[model samples]
Target: MWKPVPLPYKSDSLPLPAIPTAAEIRACTNVLWDGAHRIVALNEDVVVKYDGGLDATEGQNLIYLERYAPKVPAPRLYAMFEEDGKTYLILQRIPGVPLDSIWKSLTVSEKNGITAKLIPVFDAMREAACPWPDFYGGLDGGRVHHWLFYSQKKKDFKFLGPYYGEDAFVAGMLQNFRVSTERCERPDFKARFYEKYLPQVLRGHRPTLTHSDFHQKNILVIENPCPDNQGERSFEVVLIDWEDAGWYPDFWEFFMASDRNVFSFCDEDWFWHMQQFLEVWPAELGVMRLFEKDMRGH
Candidate 1:
């Protein structure tokens, strides 16, 4: 069971740990990426991830992966601590560069080969059965960070949901969506969304372990020394950033793969190949798009 740590400050309070000082990030060179919630830096061979008093799923996910899917290549968690309401994770950095960095340089065949390598990893995830099939949430028994709640809630809001199943999860989503769009005064649109899309999404799909953010940027690749015919080089694939991983409905993988927000490299070939490698749920995606548009008030 995962224990919830009380945030040091109230919800109304401003963000904590305002931009780590030089002394705080000691020996950490070459800032990797600074996003709204966390700042990631490279400290020699280790990667340091700092979260600004919000979100505990990253560390928890790492721990879960280390125990459950040891073969799946992810950054090994070395150390973790909380200071001044902020969370810091020290991880063993994977050696290769992000796949997206070299995506444009690779030939079509090379790209396809990389996808082939990833199939086994996906298979492993699919094979790993959920300990509690009744719930739909994170590995730590927390709420899933779906786009629906993410857009409406505060950054620090601990969205820990363990909805019973797809029906419960969708109900929660609909409720939250209503709250988010209460000001719009559009009940009919909500009704239309519920009537048209909800049934299609419900399709009696079983839950499977899903790397909810399996995108090109999250995939690391290193070229194999030996090259096959056609001069296409084989590569070792390492999936990273497991913060959003959880046991989700069968269609969740397809929905997330097609999500452009995280998967920036959603090119025609990549999208097509991802569908070929895994299941594609176009109807679910259409519903998600409707929700997205509604949230954006479009």
Candidate 2:
């Protein structure tokens, strides 16, 4: 919902350190993450993430956060450019561990402390004024990046977004749904039922900013001992992976966070804690689960 401004990239500006080759990144010893892409720590202060399949919007989303939602703690993007069919993002190397790494060992008080700190981070996103009334999509009118918006077949894929209102947003979803139906060998008959149910279920919602990939793994936290209070610790939380961050229906954050695949654990404790911060939309989530089932032809 933050007001987005144009990026300052110019053709004449030099991209620092000269974008590296895939071979160079593979050879780097300080590699931090290696999955869909490679995240290499160039030094103590700087790191770079590069991949041929990376979304062009990832760096742009970081820039959006830096400018509009300053309070939302995220990595600082130093440089971003594409070379040899790969996108590279130079970022500030944050000093902390991913929340999921320590979730199981933390005491009850520590968990509550972390959860309390996270509430304000989300509030900063939710409380920001919408850039345009009823607009839903990526920053600066880019395409929406939710998992539901992705397709395996690029030739027939439609990247729908920047919808003007809830109606348009729902229409866009249905359009993508219809495309998926074409590929299904045995389409669910409930697709027709959902075609009517979805609009009503998703209707009358206002646009809100969402980190669509909200999960413990993307959250970085550092612990500090409180000098004045005995045995007390303070936590600093920073959100990472902004590729999926954008404006969407208010319920999208809770819905996306609750996804079991990304939530890291099927633990009911984690689920209960999430409800404390994210606005719960039981009906919407239930309906969307059905929508997901039909879309994937499960």
Candidate 3:
């Protein structure tokens, strides 16, 4: 179960002491100047993260999910508080480790099997309701940020390419999708495919919630607990890090999820998969559609 960790909060209002030394903090690749994630110890409970955002609303979503919904395969949020410029998520650090560390060892059948298992969870989310107003909805709660859509007259929301590391290898993968799918008419459409995919082609299929960051790192393996966990592992696939989850079409997670090498299934397989995937993809997500719409004149 992806339940939040329980902590001794409230009575202890003051922020937890810093773990000391940038060396120590820097050692954990998960740490940020905006915050930090330390192991503490193998068995030691509670992951101490520091966040500067005053509201801590973003952090609260994890807390809420950790408490209310343990069955949906998300980490538990035990306690959180904001003081100074920092916020912390005292969560039950997920047991199994990052999926990528173990992805290479999985046989082809195992890989496809894992891919198959993830679908039902996606279906479960699709059948649910979107809590937020915009297309980007949160799984636990909705509307963590102020998101504006494109206006035909205005052409809004123009940030192109991956926003974070979890958005890793997206631009490159799309480039490959274009060349392999033979839709390389326009470069910009290749970039904004998802923006068009939603509300346009996918208006009908939009169901419940989606773990927008459904990649290797955010997902944890259950049966083969990363050799590190040794024993005591439950839940074969636990979804962690509900940062950008929301109500979205299944295609958002399906075709878009890729690796540095994460492309369509086979050589010509890209064409068929792209054709099938675009059934729901926004006009912007397809290079051909983009080339036709915004790049024809050029």
Q: Could you tell me the TM-score of candidate 3?
A: 0.53
What is the C-alpha lDDT profile of model 3 across 182-279, one tens digit per residue? 44354665445644443343333343345555566777876753433433223377777665554444455543443222343464232332232223
Model 1 gets an lDDT of 0.69
Q: Which stretches of candidate 2 lie over 4 Å from their true place?
A: 1-27, 151-154, 185-188, 225-230, 261-267
Residue 188 error for model 2, in Å? 6.0
Give lDDT tens digits, candidate 1, residues 1-298. Answer: 4443342312222123233343566545567767744445554456667754445577777767777777677776655666766677666666788887897788888988898888888888878767775678887777786656553444545564678777777777676666666545566677556646676666687778888887788899978989986677889988887877887888888777777533444544677667656787777777776676766672
Error of 2 at 166 (Å): 0.5
Per-residue lDDT tens digits of candidate 2, residues 53-166? 785588888877777889899988876666676777778889999988988787778888889988898899999766787888987667788767765344746466778889
Q: What is the alpha-carbon RMSD of candidate 2 to the true structure? A: 3.5
TM-score of each: 0.82, 0.87, 0.53
- Which residue ranges in model 1 land beyond 4 Å of their true spot? 1-27, 37-44, 52-54, 151-156, 195-197, 261-267
Candidate 1, TM-score vs. the true structure?
0.82
lDDT measured at residue 41 in model 1 versus the true structure, 0 to 100: 56
Select the stronger candidate by TM-score from 1 and 2.
Answer: 2
lDDT-best of 1 and 3: 1
Q: Tell me, by lDDT, which candidate is best.
A: 2
Q: Once model 2 is optimally superposed onto the true structure by TM-score, how far is the C-alpha of residue 96 displaced, in angstroms? A: 0.8
* lDDT (Cα, 0-100) at 197 in candidate 3: 44
